[model samples]
Target: MLATYPIAATEQNWISVTLLNALRLALESLIQGNAAPDFVDAISEEYRDAFVKGPKFQTLYEKFVAKCGILTSQQCAQILDALLDQNNFPAVFIATTTCSSIKDALPEVHEAAKDLFKHAFDKLSDWKSPGSEHTIRATYHQLVDAHLSHGSCPFCGYEPIEADDPDLADPDLDHYLAVSRYPFAGVNLRNLTAMGVNCNRSYKGAQDILLNEHNQRVDCFDPYGNEQVALSLSGTTILSGAGEGPAWTLTFDPDVKSQNWRRIFRLETRLKSSVLEKHYKTWLKQCISYAQKNNIDIRNMDGALEAVGKFKTTCEFETFPTIARLKTSFFDLIEAALNDPVGGERMHNFLVKAA
Candidate 1:
């Protein structure tokens, strides 16, 4: 859910040049209706530099041409156009199965295409220049620093457990489209997002988060979106605000796509961890202290509730986002407790004991 930079200029230039050249070669074969032998020869000659320098391209080109044999000229053109225009090669490959023969060839063609994309990224000599390396590394740290400063994993809203020396290594750069599957997107700027290492390596790992069962594209909740549904606790009883709840849940929204995103990332389980609960309890204790220090009369339940609500509302925007969501949700439970006569007395007694 974090913001990411646009593709670096050098990376974009390399992809455009390499993919456009590869597509042109394929188009030539398609137009001529070249058989296997002719197709191989044509590609070998046209992409002599890439084929000779990167032997893997020969295999990729062969697989791609084999797959293309099943496609009509219009279909080939459409795929190429989509790649050029939107940088969404996977969508085209996954969605269009007009030729039954293409079904068996799809997986091979996909891998070859990914290899080609990765090869192209490697060809950009300037891509890993010292300055470029510094920039990328710095960007990763900056993103993590910002998240830590804000108090949550931007992707799942969990508190990030940072190392004492976070600068010694960068947090993982999650490929929104797993690089293992979509090699072409390995260096695509929009494909990279900074996330907690666990979220990257443990939770997501090579899973294609971009498509649904019908192979249609599913838009993820944009980390950079202007607004988002916050996480909250549910099933909390009015008598005891913190005990015996039905675990945490996101404030429900009707956006199925966002829901799918949450499912893929397992955000609910991640955010409701014991560590987060500890943090939430600590914050609640602090709230109680603040109320007592400020002379909020606990017996005046309405005023106390209002005061607590106001404090949480203010802190919701001030602290890290994970904490903010936790605070708001917890505050809702506290407010409910204070509003009930029996619960209010219990809550007052609880706060008094804690104080």
Candidate 2:
């Protein structure tokens, strides 16, 4: 699941107004050698066409820097930051109802893209020339708008995705956000990352919601209050909840579970419920007869444990590696507990000690 952040066009407007005002003041001060008394009034005209405004903004910036003679890129960035900070401007978010595509009219919302270029020019960091800087910052804003425009959860309405599933056939930016936000998803950092095109508009986001231990939304857990959700692992299964009744279950599927069981727990997978009914019926009958002759019920602890354990160690536990090995180990443990009295006692004691 991914963590969602909120940004609004109203926030963007605030930032825009502040940046324009600062640009006016900086340019006026450079030209006249004093702050213009009507600088604030001049900034009131909102310029929405970024492609045109970009060049106009550059002309004004050059006039100022040429006059001042010593502004650096880092200094310009600081100035931009300081000017915006004075107005307490927030990060911008495009409204969900505003546009059909991310690229449409985005410059009108985020004029700071041009200013970021000014800062880049002052920094001389990577961009060797002005044209490159403009192109790069423009692209940055485009990516930002694209990211924002498609933010609503793919599955659920309004709310953003909490996480992405690897099973998704069309994972995109949404999926990346979903995985990046997972609390304990370190393993996925490398394996599950998808390109922007691959994850976009892929899965319905809401269906991916993971329940907290109480089976409620984990986000409901107060970050600073009594109710809190914690992340942990039950053997190899990812567990999320406070336990009495977990808010959600994130157990591996059957194959994963069985493979881990066989390798780690050393239980039998072949003699699984359905398998015994289909092909191992005669072998089970023979075991039952052996138990009867020994004056023990096949269902008894001693008889069952030995039979299950023998199948696990001899048949499935020794094969495979990686995920398959993990499944085999988990099953082997179950078989051991059911097959031998000593194995059951030892397993119980080990669990008790671990707890």
Candidate 3:
């Protein structure tokens, strides 16, 4: 959430498109009455035999045969004219992240082609076999080539990710739209993104992002957009009336995307427990110890202010592997709080006592 990591999906992400397109071709023809005999035989004529034959969709191909008989010509025509207008994926990203509902955003088309798409995309599970030629080896290599996993997860900058090459491995690809629900997006590149394992499986595990903890619908952030998570990292009076140092709170900024992100990942409460509350005192202790070794006096406002500046340099924003922006904001807030009359005296006292 601290940095902006941009990624764009293209049709050239062919490893993903190949399987999905086969389903699309079958369904489009099925809806046209006299459909091609399963997708296996149809796509072979249209595409390279290598692509169509590497992995077989035996279950779906048979299902297509059954669908042709179950639906009347009238029924097929009705579906064909509806919003399911494309032979292949639209390639457009989900327009809204907050809710499963949006015009032409794949939700409406779920039921119409639900089984068709779900089965086709379900082949993804098989694509994981390392030794199989049918595996999505090309897709994984493409992700590394695009550098989608080059840095910390953009979803939550709390975990570190390996910068792997094509030969090593690939980053965890999160189904941003949750292909389980919107299986039509199973192979859509925009719907898949690199996320840290913690954020992908731990915090956001099986939970839909479009809804809050209370299950209320909301808009979510585009993972690859200009969205930067804004968290308030500040030196705040502890208010516990017993603790001896300043405290920190990683509160979300008052914006729709921020609020949804916080709820979706439980960011504020999680960070408060994991980072801010857990580390606040230790950070203060370290700063005080560093100042003491350097003989930076902290019995008064001027001395406390000087030591604060020195502490800032020791843990510069770039140094934090997790929550770099949060620490940077903490520096700004600490400086501001130290400039205030009441806050300055309080910090000065705390610093002297800490020393």
Q: Each candidate: RMSD to true structure?
A: 6.2, 17.6, 5.4
TM-score of each: 0.66, 0.22, 0.74
**lDDT per residue, candidate 3, 1-355, as tens digits?**
5555445433234434564555546556766765545555645443345445544455554554465446665554444333232222322223332223222433333443455555544455344433345345344435533554336666666666656554555567676766555554556555666677888888776666556678665656665566665566653445336754445555555455577677667776767777666776677787788778989887767777888888877665443445556555555666676787766666566557766
Q: Write the per-residue lDDT of candidate 2 for residues 222-330, one digit (tens) a residue.
A: 1112221111112432112323211221233334212321232122322232222243334344444554565553344554555444433433322212222333344
| lDDT digits (tens) for residues 196-267 of candidate 1 | 777788777877676664656665554433345645566644343456533555554535656666667677
Better of 2 and 3 by lDDT: 3
lDDT of 3 at 131: 39
Model 3 alpha-carbon drift over 4 Å, by segment:
8-12, 44-47, 72-150, 165-170, 213-217, 234-240, 244-249, 293-295, 317-322
Ranking by TM-score: 3, 1, 2
- Best by TM-score, which number? 3
Per-residue lDDT, model 3, residue 140, is: 45
Clashes of 2: 61
